[model samples]
Target: MQLDPALPALNQTVLISGPGPFVLLGVPGLVALHAWLSVPVFLLYMAALAGNALLLGRAAADKALRAPMYQLLGLLVATDLVLATSTVPKALAVLWSLSGEISFEACLAQLFVAHVAFIAESSALLAMAVDHYVAILPASALQGTPDRYSVVGIVAVAAVTHGACVMATPVALLQRLPYCGQQALPHTYCEHMGVARLACGDMRPNIWYGLATTLLSPVLT
Candidate 1:
């Protein structure tokens, strides 16, 4: 493809593209069925949200469920709520209205929240496992069991670590690359590497970082 001679910057070999909106193509090969698909997807989203909300409410109301294990379950429920809320509204909009344009900033925010919530949920599950292990052990080994403060601290650390991974190198690399005007995303959500792949420049760093985080988050928890 020849560059437009009228624009000198366009002729440059390295052109840094500015941040722009992206078009999310929800569920490729299913465009023809969006009308039928959206109804069920929306219903599932609502049901999941309601179920999680009820869990949180019960945890908050009952004094007997205030144990650390129950607290971790509550955290998991909350994380699920956040994860769904982060992506479903935008996805449903794309499905129902056929409008999938998301601003670069909004897309990044969505990616961050979705990833952090997933990581947090995993961490909660790990914490629950540890709690169960401590409970099952004879009283002698239980002395070393972590307290509620420690559990809360661990969850906080997981959130911070995952948040840092998403906000640090991948996003910076995304902003530095040039895009060849390819903004269509293949999936319903704006995953970091998914958007990064649309860039015209080298995306290896973003890809590697994304893979590293995907493997490390669960292990670290």
Candidate 2:
């Protein structure tokens, strides 16, 4: 494939091993503004962490909040915490200290956790919507009463299974490709496509799978 004239030429000589560390070029155009951007990003991270922590605490402490709906909300909050923690600290490091280096394994792990949390969160939200819908159902119109706990359990299992299976495909695909040329990724976090695009070998499978997951995840949820 021909190199883009608009972009810097890949360093053909310096090939990175599969498990080697990558340089994260966080938002290339905003390099000069990284320091300025770190402030708000830090605040947002703190807010998300604090808010989720409080919600989780409330759910755990209050007996009244032990209902199926609140259980799902707890799952959502937990996933939110996971999602934020998986990427935010690294992002803050990059923005504040320009410490953008990340190991290949670490990158893939981050990608998996972040995406899984996102999918799981969506699933929880959908489950909550279903719960709301069920709340207004007429008693006479219903068949034998559905077990609320069973519904919550099913939703939780489905969310985790879907997230694990869907997100794993791209990680597996990426692992097969040989990474040559530039190791610098132009993102704050280790996104599947962003990392895949840096690989030296054919990454069409990764691209297509990533696109498929991105488009289908919402509809599937």
Candidate 3:
């Protein structure tokens, strides 16, 4: 799609298409309350990003928090901030922008970051499972919910244990894909393996890893 500068470039118009059905039905209600609602959305989003970022910051501040697992969970939460902030607004824009198109390089960038967040969340969930067994198993084998406070205490602990291992593999694999298909993605959300599925070359590794992660998530939990 190389263009010659010899001729005038095509002029394009961009508009907001908004959303369909559910959105159409919902947005007007949202807009009516937009002033109030927007404040909450913004504040809540900032809080999530801020809180997670703080955990990461605290992890760096004290040597005691430098344990391998805490460090890993801190990394995961730090990344969650990046995902919540960097990707969500652009995604909303992509849905609204009339062009509804993204550059291939941009798409790949989104794929990498978005998948990392997903993996971190998955790893976090798994860590929850490990904590679940330890914290839920009562001292007398008949204790109630109060006995599970230890699991709640160790949420960060478990997240890091699994996150370290999970983060390592994907960080390597994501940067290596060569995109050779049509530049368009059918859906707006940037999904790593789905995009990889459209790749012209074999994606056996991606498919295998995806299945393995899915199975391991539930099994390990």
Across 14-115, the per-residue lDDT of candidate 1 in tens digits comes to: 343465578998889998888789999899999998899898899899989888778878888888999999999989988886679998889888887887
Candidates 1 and 3 compared: the better one by TM-score is 1
Give candidate 2's error at residue 117 in angstroms. 0.4
TM-score of 1: 0.85
Query: On residues 145-189, what C-alpha lDDT tens digit does candidate 3 reach at each position?
Result: 443344434655454455456545643454465444334444545
For every candidate in turn, the CA RMSD to the true structure comes to 3.6, 4.8, 10.3
* lDDT of prediction 3: 0.54
Best-fitting candidate, scored by lDDT: 2
Give the clash count for each candidate.
Answer: 0, 0, 0
Candidate 2 segments whose C-alpha is farther than 4 A from its true place = 1-19
Q: List the residue pairs that clash in candidate 3.
A: none
Candidate 1's C-alpha runs over 4 A off are: 1-16, 144-146, 156-160, 219-221
> Per-model C-alpha lDDT, please?
0.79, 0.86, 0.54
